[model samples]
Target: MIVRPSLTRSIPFWILLVASLAVTVAGAAIVATTLPAMIAGLDDQTATGGLVYGGQSWITIGSGLLAAGLVGLFVLLALAAARSFLPVVKPTADAIEADDAETGDDTVLVRTDEVVPARDEVPAAR
Candidate 1:
């Protein structure tokens, strides 16, 4: 019997792909809709724009790094999933011959020396 491995058949691969895509889209949306408003609000509240700009720069860098890390994790998961679907090679002729020699008999032998007592022969508990 021969079995083939498939990535599409694996549940983990699809799960990871979906989760990564969701995180990427949601993160991007949140940043896009909120970053500008937050920066503007901070600038208005603060006496100097420099502090707000610096904070925004750090936030942008941190978000970029987080996105990159998520992407890297997704790629790693994909690679691991792909590794499971690698092709299987057939056994060599020598290996087949050795296996056949090791188990040449098709019939199995059994021994029946022990016997069990009938239900009527057992004593009831007090």
Candidate 2:
């Protein structure tokens, strides 16, 4: 029952976006820093066992956080698309009048109860 506008404008949308981005960035920073260190540790001649294990642990945590952030973003996208099928709201009377003034639509409809002559009876083009 939630409308598209209300859902997007709601607090949850911003919260999700901020939280997701924060998590993703944090994850990316951790992985970016650790991956290089881990690679160096593996190549070092006397690298301690702790360095490799610690780096691997951090990398795992960072990967998990990155996945979580991506999933959150996907959920946000789905929520935004969920109500897209709903038609847009009609313009208000004031808005309609404003548009009419700006666009200058001179066409008008006339209604009559009387019957008019057939096309055959009408005069030909001059």
Candidate topping lDDT: 2
Q: Write the per-residue lDDT of candidate 2 for residues 1-126, one digit (tens) a residue.
A: 111244667798899999999999999989999999888877875567787888899999999999999899998888778655444443345544554676766232222233322223556799
Error of 2 at 23 (Å): 0.7
Pull out the clashing pairs in model 1: none
lDDT of every predicted structure (CA atoms): 0.58, 0.71
lDDT of 1 by residue, 1-95 (tens): 22223466668777776777666666666567557766677768853565556557756765775596588567957787666555443444454
User: Cα miss at 41, model 1 (Å)?
Assistant: 3.1
TM-score of the candidate numbered 1?
A: 0.42
Q: Give me the runs in candidate 1 sitting further than 4 Å from their true place.
A: 1-4, 42-69, 76-85, 88-126
Scored against the true structure, residue 97 in model 2 reaches a CA lDDT of 58
Predicted model with the maximum TM-score: 2
